[model samples]
Target: MNETYDKRIMKQKTHRLLEAIAALIISAIIALIFSFLVSVLSSSQVYAQRVAGREGLYRDSVYRRVIGQGSTSLSCYLSYPQGGSSVLRGYGHNAYELGKLGEFIRAALSDTLIYVRSVRVCGYCSVDGNYTSNEQLARKRSLGFMQFILSEYPFLRRYGIRADWVGEDWDQLRSLVASSTLNERDEILQIIDRVDIFSGREKLLMDLNGGAPYRMMEQLFFPLLRRVELTVEYDLHRIIEERYRRKLNDREFALLLEQEREKVRREERLLAEQRALKEKWQADSLAVEETARAQQARAQQAGAQESARRADEAAAAAYRRRREAAREASAARTEHRKLYPLWGVKTNLYALAGLTPQGERTTFMPNLEIEYFAFGRWSLSASALYAYWDFAQGEFWGVTSYTLEPRFWFSPTGLCRGLYTGLYARTGDFDIRRSVVEGVPTDNRTGTYYEAGASLGYVLPLSRHWYLEAGVSGGYRRVADKVYDVEQDKHYLVRNQSQSRLRLTDIRLNIGYRLGKKTIK
Candidate 1:
């Protein structure tokens, strides 16, 4: 009786152990499936949509507050940072130095908040017709300031900073006259309104002190502003986000922060370099101007005496013109040289319509190509081709192929006026379409073709470093195909050949563009 009781107890223990193991396996499977469902649901959430909707509302409110109908006109001084210039201020270091102030204004604008979409920075001087009054000089100063910012901080490119020259604001003279006492008016001093204007954002940076009620109306408020200022209309929330908000970390948050900090430091260093270079340039320019003035004065004194040497003077003038032209051309070529080679892909949509000796066929061929230039005048390319066609309305067929052609070219001193030419060899597959003459399926022959060719082309550059290309070429080709027996046995194979070798005449006309780099190797 005791032995039988022990056996029953062992059986119950074994069954319990098996049941526990099964339960664990089921729990693990359930956990995995639940996790997958949670992930899928979370991924489909419209978090970005919600954030964008909130941002839109925030923008509208900011705009109304910044520039409203009831807002009174206030005068503000436009203080441009000293030493700024434009990109086109005669080729030299001073070019950027003259436009630095414009750079500062460009950097500070926020498209999302301030709505400062466009800015025109103008530089003017006090002199009526003196050196300072030269429109080009002031213009250069404005442009110099613009270029400095653009070169140092590429972000300013997004703000669209432009520069111009309006030597003096004569319209404001009447206002200045009205506000000045009779004796003070005799001082011949100029009064300018300094209002940096931005669209859509009403940001009040300055306030006019007590003055004539019509004082703001008569003379322009910000004409003589030496510095750069922005006129803006903005939303309050956007301003807050732009000025104070922080972005949430998705992952490796520390890495992102480090990257941002590095970028900031790099920009700061570039700005400092720009400032130092500009200061030196400004000093140099001032000295050059002083020397030029002295020379002009001396020339005037010698004007009468030099008349007998007219030929020499004429020669000197011609030499100066030639020198100027050469300088401009050299500058253009330097600008055209890109740091990297041109890289782009091409897709050809090909259609062929012709009556062959056998029948009429319409074909569509697709060509895909990828090309890259290794460096100065050297390039490599690869391409794939595919075609599908039907002939005689039910008689004949189609093919797919890939071809890779690599070649090298060189520009020989004066070949085609500084252009280049190259010779290339190509090999690829050619396929025949399916056809049925009797109630039997016909064989589709696959063949290989080899061709060699040469091409001549010229790169014609347009305004702003854009290029137009044209070329021509010719080559020879050979093809062969294989035939199989009806029984489809490996040992039963035959080759059929017709028009296997031929001299080919190929002519090509191409129009394309290059971007990112001028030289494609």
Candidate 2:
């Protein structure tokens, strides 16, 4: 009755521990999961845009001019020092032109989306000079500017440049004169038609109307002719290499649209100079050029819109790839964060109960089973126990035993956190005695025994590093023992060997702790 009561008490304590700790474990898990999600989401979100039309990364500097990519074309007009000089002057008329060039160059140089591919400088001289001298002057002017650009920004040399000079820009003069509201505009146009540059064209203009029309042309239309035009072509990185990519947002699209509008306005200005197609003027060719320029502007606008749509799609695709990569990374982290134990130490509650020859439990008994799972699924366990209880004359009952078991867990994790089965062999020595008191005889028994068996068990996790287990073993047992009866302080042997038996050898309900590294999360 007393042993049964003690066994019941141990079971109650185990249940109470489970109830008390489960609530705390659940609360901690909830807190940990919540904090992890918050951190992941916060770090994943990024709020920013591609700077205007371009931004750079370290890889951008090494990327070559991507071939077969779209191109950006730009043209600008500049003021100069003289007809033959290539030098840039800051204080004089050069100031206005330098300021314009500065703003334009800054934008191009800073843009990461494109690289300078080609530069073309076109120089034109006025009609007053002789053809050969004017041609020489224009050539020098174009050459000087091209050399200045290469020297100022040496990187442009990688792409190189082309220079074209117009010796006498009679076309530009005629166009400017036609647009002007000068009193001598009609007479000047007639004079230009009548004389060639080598055949006294400058002399006839000097003789016209006491040189009033000639002087006016030299002052007004001539300055417009003595100008240089610089054209730049850039290679779009997106066309060259997809690695240097950015999403085209509204701001970038608006900037492209404004550039297209500027082209249209420049075309309108040319149209003003080339208006009125009469037989004498023969302006049909100029009209055709203006129409073609307008068509080119339309094509550019269409290309920008298409590029923006494609860029947005590319950005979305890139985001999806990043999310997929993050999930793979998180799975790796989770695997590292969970732990599986390779070794354990445990005690069986049933062993300490009334299951032995003594038929009683004692707190002083020492029982331990050390289990080792060398790999994932297969394991070996060794159990040992020694018990000693003594009182007055011939009243002693105790046991000393050792057991070995080899186990296999069916669980995929092989943590023994689920069901498992094993085979076991055990050997032991025991002594039991009693004194003649209150109708009990003075009987003694000293014995040695061995058993071999198969076992089945289950292990349940009680905490991260703790487990509760139960199993039973049943097979053949062999015993060789001496039985004794004591009378008048003498001993009598009853048998030398007891019969072999097939029976249950052990019953187990164990509590174990895993020993290994701590879990990461």
Candidate 3:
């Protein structure tokens, strides 16, 4: 019987080992299949992302050409004295400095790619002439500057040089009035704002505060406006193409060429629109002139005076319509300004509940925090947490803690979205019960403690103004408690009595409201 039992036990052991070997082999096969599937999925996802990224780059290239990155421009200030000639050499007050104008023109002409896009010459006089004479003087000054440019750079004659002049530099005058310490500053500004006509503005300024404001503007501001502004547009395409010719492949070059063609089309379309507007304006002016002639002829003829009156009314109506149309067309061509938020401040109130590792107490922490964002990505916050705990043994207590944290966000455009990590320091007071010793009851201990820790958190936007956040923090804490020796009936101080162990200080879920302007990237 003993021999038979030994044989059976040996057989059973062999069967069990075979079964174990089979199971391990099957597990290996399953793992290989899973790994292969994961690799295939990962490769597909990477390929999809690459295609999407390429498409986005293509779109952005077109947008950059259509809207234009920005125009590159050069500007120089030309100052003139009162009643001075606008000729470059005739700038008598700064003749020695004006000699540099030749060098400036030489440098601009030296660059083959630099094109003189436009020239604007503005002239000013002391608030001395009637609007008509002031307008003529301004035009003459502009012509003087234009003649100088033409004489020096005759090659620029092919390019259209536009001359614009304002009889009075009202904008500059108002700026001077605003900055001046004169007693009539407010009255002058009121006049500048209230008067729509140039003559009315000048008259009002002359009437205020014994015309002291007008004198201030004439001495300080008018000279600053007697100048010319030359806008030089340069072609960077040649430089960019040369730099990237060897780097970009055929496909990229083709796309770049397409973008350039689109930009040319856009510019042509804008020019056509401007030409149409100009033609319409001219036609409207001619029609108004003809109507005036017909009205005058009818008024001279007998019994046609009433018809002339009707023609006069119709001319006024046509003039009003033409002005309105011009205003609308001008508004359509104006560019919209882009805005961005530089800094922001926000306040958050959160209710957090969690338990200590011992599970002896359940904590309810209410937190109030204020955060300041700087340079978009970095934020610093100061928070106060008041924690109330309920023990299973019918004991209750509260602790107050203050935390200072500095966080950095991964998103560049705004706060309150994406992942963040931060370092924190917390200091607070806590009360807890010490273990019972011998037959004595548990000792109630109270003292202050401090913790230093790090945290990882994520923020998700719930709406335009609200966000949800969750995080975990862990650190070592040093506790100093006062212990009572019941046998001696006295209390003693225990300093640094708690061992340093990794403990979870807080598990927070927060709902926050964002204040100030919110930006999205």
Candidate 4:
């Protein structure tokens, strides 16, 4: 019977070993398949990137420029009222010219085989002030022009539109000086060429010939400088590479171009409707402004009459006020005899059930606070709190802390009943144990830490003396502790002591009682 039992036990052990070997073999096969898939995906990604790079190169090389320097470029000039973005009504013809330019851009964008890359709007300002002010003025003019364009043709926003400022254009000034019939043309040229800074140039011109050159430039070249210049960059679209173009027939390419043109026409119609709406809105806005101005004038006249009436009434009230003031002085003297306490003490119940570093564990804390109201709507406070924690399962033992806080309350009249904020300083000692394997205590040591933080909270009165409060505090804690390392299922002391910076976060809730005056209101 003993031999039979031994044979059965040996058979069971052999079967268990075979099952373990089978699982290992299956795991190896799955790992090899996963590695193969990763390598294939990496290769494909590299190849796709290379192909995209090549395609970009081909597009740049084969595409032709359509609407830049040598080709057709359009220009429209609009004048603005002095120091304003509104178009000058006397130069209303410029608006019509701008409308024509918009039509041309719309037509170009409608073309299926053309790609509009960008539109550049360069703004220039007159030499009316220092370089900084002029630069800002130029940018405003440029932005004003761009706004007008987008308002007129809302569809053009899709194209890259850039606004640039050339504050007091020196190049344009130089050109004007060269071509003008002024007597001081040579002197102006010499001044422009000699000075590199804008302020120096302005000063030189003002000093030259008793400021004659400056006045002439302001009248002639300055007006021209306060303008916006527009430039559009576009290119012909290339759908396929040069080598692949032979594969597509002419009819297919034409169909593609025709489809693109249809889309452009639809967008243009939508933009035209938007432009009409914008014009109607502007007309209504002008009418509203005119009405407001008339009403404002009438209000001013009424205000003057009302002021005179108030002056007459105020004279009569002054005589009566003197008689009333004497009576109130006697009453106030009797009320001033009552005395109120200016100090208060409170304690928080919620600090006892606070959370600890180990999520499931909680610490018991007791806190006390004292406050003094020194002036109107201002008070100062000081508080102290103590905490203790122990968690055998989490390897923590005998952790304790003490904190001191100083606070300032903004509403002294509503002390312990309104809003309060404060700062705190904390120091603590802890003894904890950790394991190489989870749930197994392998190392134990004690440490000390210190932290400082700020807190904000609101106090709501439950009764005349009791209050409920909630707040959050955060700061940095520096810890001095022993370090342990776990390897080969064994624990080793790496360092007897080490320092680490830790971030501390705490949420607080309080149920406290106040001793002193009740809420004022």
Best by lDDT: 2
lDDT of 4 by residue, 1-521 (tens): 43563464356346534643553464356446546644643552121111111112121211223311213445455765666765443575775867767676654454323445677778887666888888887788788878877787676687778888888788877898899999999988988888876438778888999998788788878777767777766532343322234445667655644654454454455445556555554554455455545555555777776555554455445434434443444333322222232665555545445454334444444455666765555556665554333444554444445666666666644343467777878786655564324655567555578888777777776644446777766777677875544344344555667555545445656654445542211
Cα lDDT tens digits, model 3, 1-521, are: 44563464356446545643554464366446546644643552121111111112222332243225323323234554554445656454445544565565544444222323444444454455677777777778767767877787776666566666777666766787688787877887887788875547767777777887677777877666555555444333432344244455567766775665565566557657867886887788788878877776777785676887887887887788688768866753532111132332222223344344344434454446666666467788787655544444534444557789888888665543679888989898655543445644355555568888888888776544446777777787777755433334333333335545678876666665455452311
> Which is better, 2 or 4, measured by lDDT?
2
Selected candidate, larger lDDT, 1 vs 2: 2
Candidate 1 runs further than 4 Å off: 1-309, 312-316, 319-323, 326-339, 347-362, 375-377, 391-401, 412-418, 431-446, 453-455, 461-468, 472-476, 482-495, 498-502, 505-507, 511-521
lDDT values for all models: 0.43, 0.63, 0.57, 0.57
List model 2 lDDT by residue over 1-521, tens digit each: 43563464356445534633553454356446546634533442221112211222212222222222233333334555444466565635766776666666554454333456677787778777678888898898888877877777676666677899998889988898899998888887887888777778778779988999889778877777877777666543333233235455556645654554454454445434334222213333344445545555665778766655554555455455546545554554344334477788787777655354334443334467899877678889999866546545436655667899999899886455688889999998776675657644556676779999899988887755667898888888998877766555445556666869888777788877676543431
Which parts of model 4 have CA positions greater than 4 angstroms off?
Answer: 1-75, 86-94, 103-113, 181-183, 236-521
Q: Give the per-residue lDDT of model 1 (tens digit) for 92-144.
A: 43345435434433323431235343545555543233444455656766666
| TM-score, per-candidate, Cα-based | 0.37, 0.35, 0.31, 0.31
Q: In model 2, which residue pairs have backbone atoms overlapping below 3 Å?
A: none
Candidate 2, overall lDDT?
A: 0.63
- At residue 229, what lDDT does model 3 achieve? 51
Top model number, TM-score: 1
